[model samples]
Target: MLGRTPLDAPERQQEVFAAVLGVLAEVGYARFNMDLVAGRARASKASLYQRWPSKARLITDALKANLPELPQPDEGTFAEDVRQILLAWGEPTPFDTAGIFLGLLEGSRQDADLACLREEHVDRAYTEHLRVAVDRAKARGELPERLDADFLITALISTFVLRSEEQGVIEGIVDGLLRPLIGTFRAK
Candidate 1:
């Protein structure tokens, strides 16, 4: 009974994805719906369903594609690598995504589909980013050989992702938290 929105063509995938993110940034995940994305992308709802079975799946895929990659900094030190990671994610746009991320978290609690998406996509990506940098640090003798990258990353992410109503305060807060953590790692 629903009208098809033109997303069936394979070539339109990129447009569809862009539209998804735009919609997510605009209205966020809670108010977001397939129809809106389809309309924005000028694609069919059926085409979207063909590619992603649920809204969470669609958004997760788009996020993975759109989010900036966390590269292992080649600053030749663990401290610099950590600083790069914090700085890259501390940008205003990334901070804005944090709200959508929190919405995803709350939604995941009630939606099994979203929960799986967060675990498989978000968690894995976060772990892999930190793991690469930490492994490199260990190889360079900057960190203890047995240091747990996951725990360290969790601590970093907790501070990086803290909610802040005032955007201007974010840099100072992240700096205060990261300096000690980086120093601790450097001391090892």
Candidate 2:
């Protein structure tokens, strides 16, 4: 959060994040060097590095910024909360997350630092985001307390892991499969 000091306002931080995401989406992670993002943001590499300790952190922050803040549920049903969480996978556009998932798993196998970030940042963000929705459901008495929301969250996201390459998942396959599992939590 402290990395984006370039602009005076929250919106300016968004501008920086957008520039970085453009580069990442266009160039992919390998070629998206700090200099390129700095050039786009019209800031120095020192500024970028000062804000984010590494390229991975920079990208992660950029991705985090681009997303709307976690959904706060007012919907009366667990089904709606679960749907919102599942629908995040289809938002904007879908990418081949399977490849990225495998790459992170394998890349972390060789690089301890990368593994640590993967474990702490990327993985945590996903789980915690899902947990927010799940927790809201529980508070509303929509989900039984016995359900392990953590495991269900993992399973929900996992539905898209292996098949993100197919591109048809966005249509409904993901939500279709996961809804049945999460639907059980709906308030009767």
Candidate 3:
């Protein structure tokens, strides 16, 4: 008979979130369970169930809670703003981001709930921030009239995802890839 542990405390909730991420990273979504999170968090499984009611809800909330505050850079120049955003995006997390991402990808394939949660919670946030920067650049006439903001944002995000493991990749991507690409789209 598991009893409910109070999760009202902010620190307690953070501890649980950390545990959830750790378990998700280690075992992936299919093998992840409330019991594992409870053991790692030192809380009763019932407490988590009481609070979240479902695995997808719990995982989504935990990921949202752990996400870094998105940076809003107004460096005037679109290129510099993007460079700042990339630097902030590459900051380290407390958990294994790669492992958690892999787990989410695996779980999302089978679980509609998890898939929706990932798209809504994880992907949307990053996309929205990038969209803002692109919109600003367009408004300032820094980008070409026909430039595809969506394509630019997606390309920037993809570059970060693919080359993030390489050392100095953020600066390299900005200076070597992004700057050159943006140059092609500058107002003549």
Candidate 1 lDDT: 0.70
- In the predicted model 1, the residue pairs found to clash are 5-43, 5-44, 6-44, 7-44
> What are the TM-scores, per candidate, against the unseen true structure?
0.69, 0.56, 0.84
Q: Which ten residues in a row have the lowest lDDT in candidate 1?
A: 1-10
Sort order, TM-score high to low: 3, 1, 2
Q: Give the Cα error of residue 75 in candidate 2, in Å.
A: 5.6
lDDT for residue 29 in candidate 1, whole number 0-100: 67
How many residue pairs in model 3 have overlapping backbones? 0
Q: Is candidate 2 or candidate 3 better by lDDT?
A: 3
- For each candidate, the alpha-carbon lDDT, in order, equals 0.70, 0.64, 0.84
RMSD per model, one decimal: 4.3, 6.2, 2.7
TM-score of 2: 0.56
Which candidate's lDDT is highest? 3
What pairs collide in candidate 2?
Answer: 3-51
lDDT of 2 by residue, 1-188 (tens): 53445464677667777777677666655566789987887777787788788877776666565543455454555566555655665555333355455545554666577667766767776677668777777787766788788777767677666655556664454356545654654635
Candidate 2 segments whose C-alpha is farther than 4 A from its true place: 1-12, 72-78, 87-115, 118-122, 132-152, 158-175, 179-188
lDDT score at residue 37, model 1, on the 0-100 scale? 91
